[model samples]
Target: MRSGIHPETRPVVFRDRAADTLFLIRSTAAASKTIVWEDGVTYPLIDVEISSAGHPFCTGTARVVDTAGRIERFQRRYGRPATHRG
Candidate 1:
């Protein structure tokens, strides 16, 4: 480790506005806002559009794509026969 070369890493809060979720973690990122955590301590608050809190995979609400319909549309437009498999 070198001295005076590494970015400052400390506890920071990542806030997801849409989900209203907050996460406390160590990061070198900077923010202009601050918030008091549950422990009565203030930390830099970084506002993010999405995080694991609201992500489809993490929230278990992922959307399914209409693959069959898309394939049919593609075949019709390109004049290709639809290949069927067992």
Candidate 2:
């Protein structure tokens, strides 16, 4: 509860590139850019590479790699027995 000892907590916008999504929130982080949010007020803008909006799991488009199939193909090409286990 001390004064002048904590970083400034202010409204900020986090933008996700892949999903073209923007969110309004509060943070103590600093940014060099700013943007006007839906509330018609300007706030610091932080550009992020990924967020829940663009995440595969959140979007329900996650892919499961076929490791077993790849191992079988490799064995066939090398004439070796497949030793991979699920």
Candidate 3:
């Protein structure tokens, strides 16, 4: 709560190129470019490569790897048999 000791937190826009999405949130992130939002107001625009919109985790596209299944799939595709040695 001290004055002049913390970076200013202001409204900024984050753009996800992968998802082609734009989010308006308050952040201390610095921006070298600006863009006019839908409200006809200009805000700092930060370009991001990934975000929830484009992330597999959020989009339910992530695969849960099963070791046994993975080995079988790999063997089938590559024709390298999986060896189990005890």
Candidate 4:
């Protein structure tokens, strides 16, 4: 690990737009915008589209992004039917 070569990492607030949530975390990301946190200290603001609060896997509402469709199509093109082994 290098000392001064790495970007400055500090406490930043990540706001999930979709979930309407805010959490403080240490990150290297920076922003000109700032907001006062619960501790009454200002921190850099980072707006995110999605986070664990709104992610499909975390929410258990997975979305099919046509990848499943592609797999189904490939299987239809080259798959064989199961035969009775008994």
Candidate 5:
């Protein structure tokens, strides 16, 4: 560990807006907001769009993409170049 070279780390509250969940973890991220935790302690609050709580993969609600269909659509749009046969 080097002094004066690393960002200060503190317990910060990350609020997942999508899932409406809160997570308390130590990080070096900056935040201008504050929030009181369940322990009645105030910490820096950072609002996040998504987290493990709301992610499709973590919740096992992920959908399988149709790559074949996408390829067909792309080919139909731009089309493939013709190759010359000698």
Candidate 6:
């Protein structure tokens, strides 16, 4: 660690608009807004479109892509590659 080498970090409130959730955590991020937390303390407020609370991967709502099916369709449409002969 060195002096004057790290960004300042403080309690910041991240608001997940999609999930309507608020999380207070220490972060180096900055915001132009502020929010009063549950502890009655005002913190920098940063609004996010998505977070773990609303993300499909975190909420287990993600759909697995059918890569095999897509490959099959592509091959059927274009046929297999031709082998090169010298």
Candidate 5 per-residue lDDT over residues 1-86, each given as its tens digit: 87999888999999999999999999999999999999999999999999999999999999999999999999999998688999
Candidate 3 per-residue lDDT over residues 50-84, each given as its tens digit: 99999999999998879999889887889986689
Return the clash pairs for model 6, or none.
Answer: none
Q: Which pairs of residues collide in candidate 2?
A: none
Query: What are the lDDT scores of the predictions, listed in order?
Result: 0.95, 0.92, 0.96, 0.92, 0.97, 0.96
Candidates 4 and 5: which is better by TM-score?
Answer: 5
- Model 1 Cα lDDT, one tens digit per residue, 2-86: 8999998999999998899999999999899999999999999999999999999889999899999999999888889768998
Error of 6 at 81 (Å): 6.8
Query: Pick by TM-score: which candidate is best?
Result: 6
In candidate 1, residue 25 scores what lDDT? 99
| lDDT of each residue in 14-64, candidate 2, tens digit only | 999999999988899899999988889998999999999999999999999
How does model 1 fare in lDDT? 0.95
Instruction: Score every model by TM-score.
Output: 0.78, 0.78, 0.78, 0.68, 0.78, 0.80
lDDT of 4 at 82: 79
The residue ranges of model 2 lying beyond 4 angstroms of the native Cα positions read 1-6, 81-86
Angstrom error at residue 26, model 4: 0.3
The runs of at least 3 residues in candidate 6 whose Cα sits more than 4 Å from the true structure, single-residue gaps closed, are 77-86
Error of 1 at 26 (Å): 0.7
Q: Judged by lDDT relative to the true structure, which candidate is superior, 1 or 6?
A: 6
